[model samples]
Every structure is written in structure tokens, then in C-alpha cells.
Target: MDKAYRFEGTYLQWLKEELTGWDRFPWALFGFGVGFQLAILLLNPINWIAVVSFIGIFFGMWCTVAMGAGGYDSEGNRVSSHAINGLLGSISVIAYVIINVSAGHYWSVLDQLVFLFLIDLPLLKNWRTWSGKSTEIKGLTKMGWLYVIVAILAAWFVLYYVGIYLHDTNPLWDALALAIGGTASWLCFRQYSTTYTLWLISDFVNVLLWFTALKDGYSQAALPMLAMTLFYTATAIVGKINWRPNKVQ
Candidate 1:
């Protein structure tokens, strides 16, 4: 077979495997996200933008849960869920940015835009590998570690600067969440199981961030986001367990 045909076949096969097996679906996580959104909607004034944001967050939750359940393949590489996660997460960030901007929450818009870039970077950087055109799975090298450090530092500095200069509600929480979360994304792209640990840390910070926002009346739409971050924390634990490396005989 020609290289193009071979690549197509492999990609199709991977998709087939990923899409089938309904029993493997993370129904509990999905249900929690849906139920939480609905419950919050009942309590809050119906804002169309908030509804759209909820939808985006739901998809993002789906991606996270799916990645946790799918885990890695036999060769110690992540399943194709990483690519799908990136796509869904990008959509989620766009929704967040739209809502924040419409509400004149420029700080949140900045934060979401940075997150969108982080989520999409891997897809752009490793299209061939993620698309199954290449089966190469990268190990965390010195360069990868360096990348993570740089990302964290950059995220912190930017968020801190904005928080101090622009009077953001909670710059420290934003900076910590994104710094760790961005590192997690980088580790995830490299298929490192340790990504879940960083995710756990990030999610906790996010939960606190949103909780503070809701309590302080920074945003009336913070309830759903707070709930979403709580679920994210749960999924991080699940991902950590599911992504555990198999023991050597």
C-alpha cells in the first residue's frame, strides 16, 4: 500500500476502536456534569451566554473523563483521546472567552485565551503523531522539562502582571491554576502519566478560584464554573489511577 493509504487505514482503525465500546464510556462523570449544570441553571438567572459556557464546559468534562477511562495503549502511549480532548477543550475556552468578553470581564478573557492556546499547541506541534500518521510516542526529555518550566514561569508572570496592574479579582489563583494546568497539558501531550498529578493540583486551585469568585460576587456566573472545577478534581484522580503504568513482570 502507498504511504497515504496506509496512514488512512491506521487512522480509521484507531477511530473505530475509540468510538466503539459504549460500556467503556465515562457515564458517571458525564452525568455529574449535566446534573450540576442543570441544578445551577435552576438557581441562577437564565443567561444565554452562561448556557453556552455550560455546554462548552460539558464537552471539556467529557474529554477529561474519556481520557481517564481510555488510558494508555499497550505500548505505554496515550490513546487517541488526547487529540479529541484538545479539540473539545479549545471549544470550551472559546466559549469562556466569548462569555467573559461579552460581560466585560477582560481578565477572564485573557485567561481563557491563554488556556486555549495551551490546549491547541500540542495539536499544532504534533499533528502527525496525534493524527496517527506517525506512531512515535515521545518520552519526557530534558527539552520537554525545560518547556514545562518555561510555560509555568511565563503563565505566572503574565497573570501576576495583569492582576497587579489591571486589578484582576484573583491573580494569584489564576496564575497558579494556569501555570500548573499548562504544565499538565504539556506533559499530557508527551503521554506522561504524571500529567494527572499536575491536573489534580491545577483543578484544586481552579475550584478555589471559582469559589472565591462566587462568594465575592466577582461574577454571577461563577457557580457553574465552580461546580465544573470540582468535577475536574474528581476526573484528575480518576486519570491518575487509570493512567498508572503497568508493573513489570
Candidate 2:
């Protein structure tokens, strides 16, 4: 009886340790962010979704910073997997704003700018670390710089739309912004093998939808974007499961 009891206790302890590292907070935050962004996409009568998006974005960014600060794999590869993941997801929302704006449906440029400043500006302070020797601290490198450029273009795309919507200006800025952002996102896909690359691939698809919004309308692009996001969610799940840190012997 004593031997059986000891074996059961050992198994429980092992189970607890094994499950402890399965961080889910980042995923939850990202999921909510995506949902908020997608829900705001409208065509019948354009309305402000920024209020809800603001909440989602805040929580999402919080999760990213928290996870990046401590989430490491068994290999000691500090990729800030969760934080990067949230960043990727959040960028998609920013992408959508750009596309809509470019298509001439500007709503809240100030809000968008504030959101970007809050979530991304602090990251610039850590730029030097990307070149450092530490594997955990230096994951961004050139690829990270490219990612930042893409993010900027995306934000600019939104502002460009604001100009068009408010001032009735026909801007050639959309083409330029999309070209640069797409190229950077493509580079990210080429360089990384982790979930980060997959996120970029997903963003590439969103870029296509953005173009369609420019040509056809936001509704046309938005419906398809929603469907694609479902795939994005699935990909995130697959990545989370397969990329679990390989256990150390």
C-alpha cells in the first residue's frame, strides 16, 4: 500500500512540473486582440471599433511584454515566443487599419497613432540588444529591424487613409507602403522557422486583402480577412503544441 501511494505521488509531481511551463496567457491575449480587430471590420455603415480594439490591444501588449520577459524554452532559447507571437497578432490589427485607411475609410488616426506609440515605441530602446551575443537577448537582428519597418509602413498606411478620407486627397502612398511592408514581412518569413514566420505568412495574406479593399471595398476584403484569421488561429495552436520545448534528458 505504501509503495503504491508513493508511486502515485511521484506521478502527480511530475505532471505538475510538466504542465507548469505551458504558458497560455499570451495566447489568450492575442486571441482577444484578433477578435476585436476582426469584429470592427464593417461595410454597411462604417462605425468605430477602436474603443473595443483599444482594450484588446492593451491586454495583448501586456501579455507580450510579460511573456517575453520570462518565457524561455527548454533549450534556453529565449525567443520571447509568446511576446513575439502577440506582436505578430497585434500587427495584423494594425495592418487592417492601414488597408481600410488606404481604401479611403479613415476613422481614428489619433487613436491608432497613440496605440502604436504605446505598444511599439518602447521596443526601440531595446534595439541594441538585438545585436548582442546572448541568444535570448539577441533574437531580433536584421530580421527584427525589418519587422519594425513593416510595422511602421502599416501604421503609415492608416494615416494615409486618414488624409484621403478627411481631405479628399488621392494618395499614391498605399502602393509604396504595401510594397515596403510586404517585402519586409516576406523577409521575416524567409529568415525564421518558428511561429514568427508563420505569423508573417498570415500577414502576407492580409496584405492581399488590403489590396482588394483598395480596389473593391472594405467589405469585400473584410469578409475574406475574417475567414483567413480562422486559419491564423489554427496555425497558432499547431505552433504552440509542436514548438513546446524539447524536454531535456
Candidate 3:
């Protein structure tokens, strides 16, 4: 077999062996998320889109926590929970976009669109890993740092212009959240452990973003999103610990 295949096989074997020990799932966190989403659903039983978004949000949150805490499948294979999270997150954001569009909140639609791109990166990375391609986590190279800088600058400029000039929304918070979160997503796609650090920063900014939106009566949907960011912030801390440089491939 080719060297790439051999390497991937070795990696999978290592993961399987590593997961053979006492690896317990975080059922408490999962239960809490389920309860939270169910409460939202009970309150908005007629809003099917909200129901769909809640389903997606719950799975996305669960998978993100699982990934941070080192998840394994029934067969002991390391589960690419980010892939699942990304897919469900995309669905959730799409539903949010529709909701925003119907409410004439074009800026919120734009925000959700950007979020879709961020989450989809992990799905792309997972596809590469599953296709016998290299998806090894590594430290950022100089070029990678440059790319991040450029991306953040570009994202900030556009988000600032759109959010400030066109909408009455919190522009700075939106810009910061998207810029940092986009960087984190790109780093994640490149398989860098440092993505967790960036994600931690982004998650805090996102909490502020949605919290302010809810406070200003932007959308009642912001409540669940705010809670989601808080959960993500906690998981990002877990990911930082679990995906430290020494532990990464």
C-alpha cells in the first residue's frame, strides 16, 4: 500500500487502542442540552423551523462536547464528531437564515451565512480524512499565520461595513465574532490544535453578540443561540486541554 494509506491505518489503529480504556461520554452535558432544546420546542410548538433548528443545535452541541472530551464509536474508532457537528450546525443556521429572512432581518441572515461557512469547514476536513487523505493536526506554519491575518482583516472589513453602514445591529461584536470564529474554523480545517484557543475567544465574542441581540429584542431565537455559545465556550476550554500541542498528531 501507499505511504499515505499506511499512515492513516496506523493512526486509526492507534485511536482504537487508545479508546480501549475507561472513556466515558459526558451524559450530563448531553442531558442538559436536550432539556434546554426541549423547553424551547415546548414553548414554540407551532414553529417547525425552530424545532428543526433546535434539533440541529442539540446534536451540534453534543458532538462538539464529544469531540472535546475524546469521543469514540461503538467499535472504538475515534469518531469525527466535528463532521456531525458541522452538518447539523449548517442545517441549524440555514433554518435561522430562513427565519431571519422572513422577519426582514437581512443582517442576521448575513451573519448566519458566515456561520455556515465556518461550520462547513470541519465537514470538509472530515471528508478528507475519510477519503484516505492526510488530515494530521499540526502547528501553524508561517504561511498559515499569514493566511489567518489576511482572512481576519478581510472578514473584519466586510462585516464592519455591512453591520455598521447598513444595519442597526452591534457591528463591532459581529465583526469580532466572525473574524475570530472564521480564523478558528480555517485553523480547524487545517488540523491545528490552536483552533481551540481561537474558538474560545470566538465563543466569548459570540456569547456577547447574541446576548446583546436578545437584550435589544432582536430575536427571541437569540436566547437559544446565546446558550449555545456559552456551551461552546465551555467545550472550547475542554478542547484546549484535550488538544494541546503535545497531544496532537
TM-score top scorer = 1
TM-score of each predicted structure versus truth = 0.73, 0.29, 0.70
For model 3, how does the per-residue alpha-carbon lDDT over 36-135 read when each residue is reduced to its tens digit? 7778667764476566567657766765664466555444444323344455566567666665554344555665676567555445455324311113
Supply the global lDDT for candidate 3: 0.62
Runs of candidate 3 with Cα error greater than 4 angstroms are 1-22, 43-49, 72-83, 99-135, 140-154, 247-249
Residues 1-249 of candidate 1 have per-residue lDDT tens digits of 012321234655645444444224466667868888888887778778677867777777876776666544433544424455555667777777775555444555665665567656565444335432112323455676687768778878887787667665677787676678767766665556667877898888888878887788767667888888888888888777656644311
Better of 2 and 3 by TM-score: 3
Cα displacement (angstroms), candidate 3, residue 36, comes to 2.3
Ranking by TM-score: 1, 3, 2
Steric clash pairs (candidate 1): none
What's the count of clashing pairs in each model shown?
0, 1, 0
**Better model by lDDT, 1 or 2?**
1
Ranking by lDDT: 1, 3, 2
